[model samples]
Target: MPDERTHARAQIRGVKETAEADLLAKKNVIGVDIADKVTDGKNTGQLSIVVFVEDKQPTSKLSAADRVPKEIDGVPTDVQQMTVELQGPSMQLVDDVTPQVDTTTYAVLHGGISMGPLRSVYLTPPDVTSAGYYIFAGTLGAMVRDRGNGATMALTNFHVACVNSTWSVGDRMVQPSLLDGGSSSNQFGSLTRATLSDDVDGSVVTVDTGRSTTPSVQDIGDVAGHTAATVGAAVRKRGRTTELTYGTVISTDFTVTINYGSDVGSRTLHHQIRVQTDTSRSARFSDHGDSGSVVMDNNRMVVGLLFAGSSDGQWTFANPIQSVLDELNVDLMVAPVVTRPIVSCLNTRLVVCNITRPVACLFTRSAGCNLTRTASCLVTRAVACNVTRATWCPVVTRTAVTCSVFTRAGCDIPIPDPGPIEGGQSEDGHGYGATADVPEEYWAGYLAALEEINELDGPDEA
Candidate 1:
């Protein structure tokens, strides 16, 4: 069912070899390729010989016959200039000025693997007071593994994590971010390697084995793995700034010029994937602080790493996740489930209920509870949890009171409980005291009774 124009293009594609040789024979013609004929920014479905030239109008003393071709093999030709240049990290260009310190709570370890935004960290060359630390804000990106030895590493933009080539390998990387008062106590990893290629802007930080870490991301859950990106693929992401969002890949093998803000000059990047936001779906592809977030496909496969974008949110760019992994010589760290002690409880009917492993409870009420995944039982209460993927495992709640639970980064549920109240007046004007004398052995039965009453009142009654 090919149209006339499509047939013509197919014909042109077959005979383009002869056209390319003839075009290259002409002066100033550097390269040639078969291309679609575009008019008014739309492809007409017709093919042409795209001729590359040094100059459209050469001022040198050359004969008229030596000029670039206007047509080849009776097909139209386009004379275009394509000069590519590569630049290193932006901090290298703007190191003369004092960097502004951004003290914000990005990410820091509270339990095991904690994910968050990255505020600027201060680093200086040895014995140089005049030197300034690289300062900027971006997401932590994701966790990856060393290809050679299977060691885990942290991933992010070369500019964001390495301060645009300002820091050296073995330099300290902290969390809660220095802007948020990070110090030696907050050190999470160290710079191990990095790459700034025509196709990528990335760095790898070797995770400190002494610290607790997880490969899971916030809201989006664990990254199953990575794959090559293709046009029209549905994609999603989670970052410190933008918790979770999704869009579709509109273009691939894209080349673009990106601005690095005020002090840093612009640079060109090639072979990028372009994602367009669907405002109707309230989609957001990227933002200023979202750089380094891993972009995943609808299948939960990692596709790209978000780096740059238009300020208006119309378009965004990402290096192929496969390319990033290859460039860094590492593989993605599969998300791991949290391990906790086994805990159980009794429902309102006095029947012992065995809470499953890897379950998270966002909230608990008298009548029901919000679990990370749906659990079915013949009890009188309802248990609800958001299920995104099937890999969710059991973990303990951040606030472990009685037998309640909470989801981890690899699970699809929100943290549901508030901190335990100490000696204070209850909302109902009942005063609670630590010194209140109650029979110790009766505590378990009393708590079960209290929970029954709470469930009967439901979550809203709180």
Candidate 2:
């Protein structure tokens, strides 16, 4: 069944690739991709090439050259009306006198939290404000590890981490972002790598020393791994602004043009994933501040890294997770699972056996001897005279007996002892032998061990 679906998807992808360029050239058209065919506002469960347009107009209103074809290369085509743009937020001033505190101010970092590069901009008279500079913020998507150096890192959008072409490696990146009231003291990491290419607009940041991170996404659970996006698959995401939202994959293999404001201009991203708010839910899938959030399927397998969305957020776009990871040369930081060895025993007639069982009993031996004497009266009578010299003889005999018995009580059961505490109590005041916060220097060692365990045993099925 899965193979058949893959083959059908591939056929649709070929048709999309062939017609994408020509479709994108049409007026009002913004993107093209493969998606489920929608008829009368209902999904038909049929694969088709989808063309996204800025506006939906009647046939008479659009020129013949601008009209989208009903079908292309024998594959059906669907025109979806929407406008797309990069999801990064614009710079804004800090207007409130009282400081605001939230997850953005979190000392420990994780995914689905606000963060951004520190940038300062001046506003003129029209935007009157006492604040001297402006700030912009976006979501911190996920935790990642560098494939080459194994350094702990965080994932986000290039526009969120870099902002402009002036960005360089080692530029400051902060938690809660400056826009979220995060200042220099909140600085957690620095930008390490970034790519704004035909397929990805992603970046990585170095997690600084003394800081710690977990693989779990806020409001969601841990990410197991990544998988390819499929049309009609239910998905969800957690972001800085939206917090948590449910959606569905409306299209895959998308190529869309996104406007990154005046600084980065417009960029064409290919092989993107398009998601729309689930019909059962009323909330938007993403917003301006949600850029860089990772999108996960129902099973918690990441499908994409969100970077763009429509103005109203009814529709959003993301770079395929595999492409993002490949471009960054990194892997997702997954949670480690605790495991214990399995013990088994076998029993035979009069014997109990176990490879790992401890010895049960100790064996010892003791011996004693007794003496006995016998006399020959008959012979003594015949040689009375001569036997006067015959004296009594003494004989001694020694005997020993051994026995063996086996019982269930004779077998020893081993009991495991808990190891000594290392960092004292956990956050909940329980002595779990581990600290709630681990030092940043130890993260590399821990991550290495986690990688080894994952390779040997794979992730926990539960």
lDDT of 1 by residue, 215-242 (tens): 6666666677778886667887775455
Candidate 1 has what TM-score? 0.50
What is candidate 2's lDDT per residue for 188-288, written digit by digit as tens? 89899999999999999999987989887888999888899987799999998877899988777879987664556778889888898874774788877
| Candidate 2, residue 235: lDDT | 93
Q: Clashes per prediction?
A: 14, 0
Q: Over 4 Å off in model 2, which ranges?
A: 1-6, 94-104, 121-133, 279-282, 343-462
Sum up the clashes in candidate 1.
Answer: 14
**TM-score of every model versus the real structure:** 0.50, 0.68
Which 10 consecutive positions of candidate 1 have the poorest summed lDDT? 374-383
Window of ten residues with lowest summed lDDT in model 2: 375-384
Q: List the residue pairs that clash in candidate 2.
A: none
